[model samples]
Target: MNGNRNSQDVVVACSRGITPGMPSFAEQIAKSAPDAADIKQRRWIYIPYDRYTDRTGPLTEQSAAATGVVIVESTAKALRRPYHKKKLVVLISNMRHFALEQAARGVSVLYVFSPKSHGQALVDVQREHALPELTCMTPAERELRLDLATAIENGLQMKFAEDTTWASRTADFTEVYGTYKPGKSYVMDRFYRKARQKTGILMQNGKPVGGQFSFDADNRNPYKNQIPVPKPPKFRPDPITEEVIAFVGETYAQHFGEIDGFDLPCTQADCDLMWRFALEHLLPHFGPFEDAMRDDHGQLFHSKTSVLLNLGRLLALDLVRDVAQAAEAGAIPLASAEGFIRQLLGWREFMRHLHGETDGYRLLAGHVPQEHRRFTQEVSPDRTEEATKAYASAISKADPYAGARPSALGASLPLPAVYWGVKSGLHCMDTVVAQVIQEGWSHHITRLMVLSNLANLCGFSPRELTDWFWFAYVDAYDWVVEPNVLGMATYADGGLTATKPYVSGAAYINRMSNFCGHCQYDPKKSTGPGSCPFTSLYWTFLERNQDILAGNFRLQMPYNTLRKKPAQELMQLRARAEEAIAHLQSFKRPAY
Candidate 1:
């Protein structure tokens, strides 16, 4: 949620540019001020990013009434890493803006732009004032934040307190959640109160705002107007925000995601707009249509809430509750509600837990930097040698029922996919990469069919595939996308998320969509210039790697089809397909 910027005593912190979802540690430290009832207080300081005259004056002006310490600085470079110049600007500018907002909330910000380490900051502070009891920085995820704190603590060496303001000191989410369990009912029960407690969501009758807690089916109707699809909200940048955009561009020049248009919500009001749209219009048709795609609906059926939800702008439980209520209110349906809830509760939580518990944190670790790869959700893969690999991998990784961890992960199964590296062949790397870079989002079909298919087809290296996907995409977190992409999509680690590779021929594409009509190549014509690229590639992929695929039952159809091809005829077909692929690559953009 967007905090009111009117507080005079608040100092908002950041490890990077503070967006709506990102938590500011400066605010946290100030907010965590030792309750004051006991009065055995320590000195605290608040830092801002802008030139400090306005913010710092308030702190010095009001310091007489405020207990302990409070100094507002324009730059907290000492608290952030200067390793990346972009990081410095992002962190400082965001902190500065947030500080101004907090000043509006009545807090002070001392502006400083020195790239000094925390120890140096302490020395400077001591020279300016006296030894303070504590140094509270803003909320930041980069390791440098902690590094700065450690440096300050080491410098102070018992003279001042340095630490995160969070209630949890250890990686003890369990301790924070208390008796929460991972099962369905156990999860549901804990979700009610725990969600509200941790996230401050409003509740009704000891339950969530929505009486029933689901509205999936209602959200699945594909037919437009079945549910009113309102315009998703956007923030028209105020002068301050426009300046922030310019600052981000000039300062954090290399940041991965595009800042152009920069219209995605970054404030509480922005997230609320998205949430309101989902509840009133999308929740009713999100499920059944969740799986469907249309050219006209850029974000059809799907609620683009990842940015908000991940950043804590919107609590997952509250979102679930609202959708459920909407459904119950005759706004949506059961399937859609259930599906949406499952994704939020089951998929998202599982991913967070998986990475938190396993080695999936860094993806693949080998410096080999596997080849780059690409793929998506409406996936259908090649039914050849690659498919055999995919099948074996899937069988090895498949959860027999659901939530049942497979026993064959190591002792009997192929290695799991490391979320590292650039993937090679069979997976289409650039397509989805382009999509994510251009648009801060991707579709399931694009992932499964296009990217995944290309990955297997191209044989792109593993590590490259993993890291590229993780870094480029906005919504990619270690949990879901890693398993889905690294394991299920890329099949980089042999097989982790799927049993077999998804491969298909011209027929399959024809079955799915009208892509054939718009293409210059004909799906029906093989072994010639007019032959479909997919059809030619499909056979070449099979023939080139028969050793791995000859035995796969799924390959029977395509292989049988290949067997009908005379060697000379197959070579011509391969040539045609290769030409098509080359054509695809030679272009600055995909003509289609």
Candidate 2:
């Protein structure tokens, strides 16, 4: 589809930009091969008409066939970018695909997909040479569409070809955001109304209604009085998703992430179905139990829209609007609308802002001490020892299944024993993630309160915890999950995201759901013999993080609770909690 005439040897220059029309992943793989034959691993990086972007870098690095290509982890690595251009380069790294949209505007083009050190990998191509630059760069789509032009121009060796991939990174940012005033009441009103109107969410005396907003109070109520709602129906698979699943199975079979059967609603039609299930089944009572938890059923009353929202298959405004509409229709109450809206507008946007600032590269730099918990290395229960062996047949890792070392701010916290006692306390955070990889789903509360709260309370490194959030959640993106994990959830990034760390005891879960009643631990006790893990862990957490949290204005009340307790008794409580966590499975659940 590209205008470039293919040569015997096509070399996609080390590029810093990406475009949409470049061949599909499978096709790119075919193109990469000397014979242009079909190969697998082609579709693991593939997204359909929908662009697959992670914003940090391109997807395709080298051509293996006329239709086969290789996935590049990041544009900087792909281009072998230099130190001076590093910061600016990151802005457009793998997110360079949209550069092609600009190319249609008639801008000068000089493209390289990788560095000269990689040799003719991303540069010029000779028509008959063994390897030429017929190469196409695949960066994440959002980067080109969203990042500033100046940022895209940072690391390139400027030269011109009749090339038409990226028109130019020559636009002005001031001229763009300047067109619309952000903080005006009218602007806010319009965005709200637009959200309402887009989703037909709130209808009033005829037209979609306004104000009387956010019935979140209703949503905050616990759902223990109610019955458990069933999971919505799943769409088995369409040809596209089926193909993707198959491809991931063969090629990425060994990749860190999981590939469940095609249960994800990838198409717009499927998303609508999933949305309808939420509205008809989950909405009316969704708010009251939004924050509640179930033992194994993680998504109690929570909106199941994350999978749809992040994939571009659905819009945020519509989602919030629909909840508003449901409230107005009296189909659901106001509290539900308010609570869900807060998640979409308030928290969703907040998370996106957080992602724009950080994406986890800093934590991956091996900065954390090895003494920290090792997840990647831990062979997941899900992986067979044989599969694990084969997966690691080539990798020379100290622990083949081990994950990257966690940062001081993420998993390296000094949690005391009492806090460590609850199975509910900083659960096998990594274990659940391994499950998520296999299942492709984790309810909001599971994500927010379960893993997130546990990690936060247990003193996991904020950065490592944030990375786990990104890696585990299907709906997670830097723009969506970063702040939620880094700021609000973990209180990592040192409190820029939340007012206070969300910490609680078994009592909170007891009050919220039926899970405590079903547990072997007693929700009432702070001491022993199957004391609710939440209780002892709560105290244990307070003891551990007290020093770091002493200056926090929001932690005043909890600190007071800790102060009232006698020191010796506190020490005994903490001791038990620590022993509990190290051998979490050994503890029996006491009768509720």
Runs with alpha carbons beyond 4 Å of true place in candidate 2 = 1-214, 225-231, 256-260, 357-438, 551-553, 584-592
**Cα lDDT tens digits for candidate 1, 1-592:** 1112112221222223446654444443345333433123333553322212222222344343253333333222321111122222223333444444444544433333332433344446554544445434432222223334555655542232222222222233344344322221113324333534444333455664445444443543333434555566665654445545554454334434456655555444555777888777776767766644333444666787764564444666667778657656777666777677666754565445433333442333242133322222111111122222222323343411111121111111111121111222222333344445555566665556655555455444333444345444555433455555655565443333344556656665554444455555566876664666666766777786676566777668777878987879888877876675655444232110
Each model's TM-score, in the order given? Answer: 0.56, 0.59
lDDT of 1 at 575: 83
RMSD of 1: 13.4
Assess candidate 1 and give its TM-score to the true structure: 0.56
Please tell me which predicted candidate would have the highest lDDT against the true structure. Answer: 1
Residues 251-291 of candidate 2: C-alpha lDDT, one tens digit per residue: 22333344544455554456678888888788787777787
What number of clashing residue pairs does each candidate have, in the order they appear? 131, 93
What does candidate 2 score on TM?
Answer: 0.59
lDDT of 2: 0.44
* Candidate 1 segments exceeding 4 Å error: 1-230, 252-258, 361-437, 477-481, 502-527, 535-573, 580-592
